[model samples]
Target: MFLKPLLHDFRLALIQLHVSAVKSENLQRACGLVREASAKGAEVVALPECFNSPYGTQYFKEYAEKIPGESTQKLSEVAKECGIYLVGGSIPEEDGGKLYNTCAVFGPDGAMLAKHRKVHLFDINVPGKIQFRESETLSPGNSFSMFDTPYCKVGLGICYDIRFAEMAQVYGQKGCQLLIYPGAFNLTTGPAHWELLQRGRAVDNQVYIAAVSPARDEKASYVAWGHSTVVNP
Candidate 1:
């Protein structure tokens, strides 16, 4: 009798999410996608930043949920049902009444694996285009977070945090084989900076980098530049 080979491999799914003001609708869409990815044999699925809410400082307070709040609960249930690892993406989390842009990860068993609040806020001014002041509504995260999975050691980073090479280096130093960034890069920077930044991070760290961005929203207060991508080491 021939024995089947034991495989210790992993596959990733990047969700180029399209967010909206309706949190319930977005959650339903994300859950559906996650299920589809799992059915397609993805062991891990990642969603874009602010998947549970709208991006922009103005909507932070209104959309903010607690860490283990509704958004996380929904993601946890999905992760458990699909038997896959899930990066729940960044959501506006209300911590002690202050808002923080946060990302949560769940294991195959739906256990909370790790959480990372966006350390670098998107605060920039581009002439004749968009202006973002994340600090005005959201507080910056002070601690760095990483976790282990069945596939490999993984690093976590939210949208603007990807722009910092130092952070990526830190993850590389921590023995991370793959880094996940959930973000919403805008039209102003998305076209010029998004892919370049992902490639740069992968080249610099010599590791796989996956970035998930919310699909473009032209009618919303802030338009998202969406081109969800994955790059290998």
Candidate 2:
């Protein structure tokens, strides 16, 4: 295991956000939550996957934004205002005419620390239950993302990427003390494997694992499992 003998302690906060179809409202709510978390002494705060817009292939093109676009601009401003590290969660990113599920991290001074495009595309057909394919509208990211903080080294991933244990092992080998995944697991797969996968990764890597998800929205087309959790090895 890659357990560290000693490391600086830091408080982490996960925002189980209620996502909406409205982009501006989503950003406002997320920023408010980050400020609240920072006020409560959280050194690092995370938002949920697809926190800025509704989670669906149909909405990808409508909500997709460039890296330095409006969504990321709000994230940077909030991080600097709160004086805390902020994980901007997964947004539909538009780069070179292709869309990707991406996560951006910012430091206390609001510098862009690292950006991770989700490596694994969630393409599962559970027959009678649910059928979804991200590849239809989104492209996969190729690189593993890691960044250094005063508290620890952080590794990033998104929703379906958590299922690959090998990715967690690589992060651990690279000395990542904490792994953060902003995910949006639907009702079908969430109850069965969400927490289980997080626990498995944390134990195997001997690192803190934070799996964040958007709050369950019953009225929406895609209902997410609302448990945003942190697991300790």
TM-score for all models, in order of appearance = 0.95, 0.98
Best by TM-score: 2
Assess each prediction's global lDDT (C-alpha) against the native: 0.89, 0.94
Tens digits of per-residue lDDT, candidate 1, 58-176, equal 88999888889899999999999999999998899998878899999999899999999999988998888877799998889998888888678889999889999999999888778
Count of clashing residue pairs in every prediction: 0, 0
Query: Looking at model 1, which ten-residue stretch has the lowest summed lDDT?
Result: 1-10
N/CA/C clash count, model 2: 0
* Candidate 1 colliding pairs: none
Give a tens-digit lDDT track for model 2, residues 1-233. 44794367889999999998889999999999999999999999999999999999999999999998999999999999999999989999999999999999999999999999999999989989889899999999999999898888999999899999999999999999899999999899999999999999999989999999999989998899878999999
**Model 2 lDDT at residue 68:** 87
Model 2 per-residue lDDT at 156? 99
Query: Candidate 1: misplaced stretches above 4 Å?
Result: 1-7
Report how far residue 142 has shifted in candidate 2, in Å.
0.2
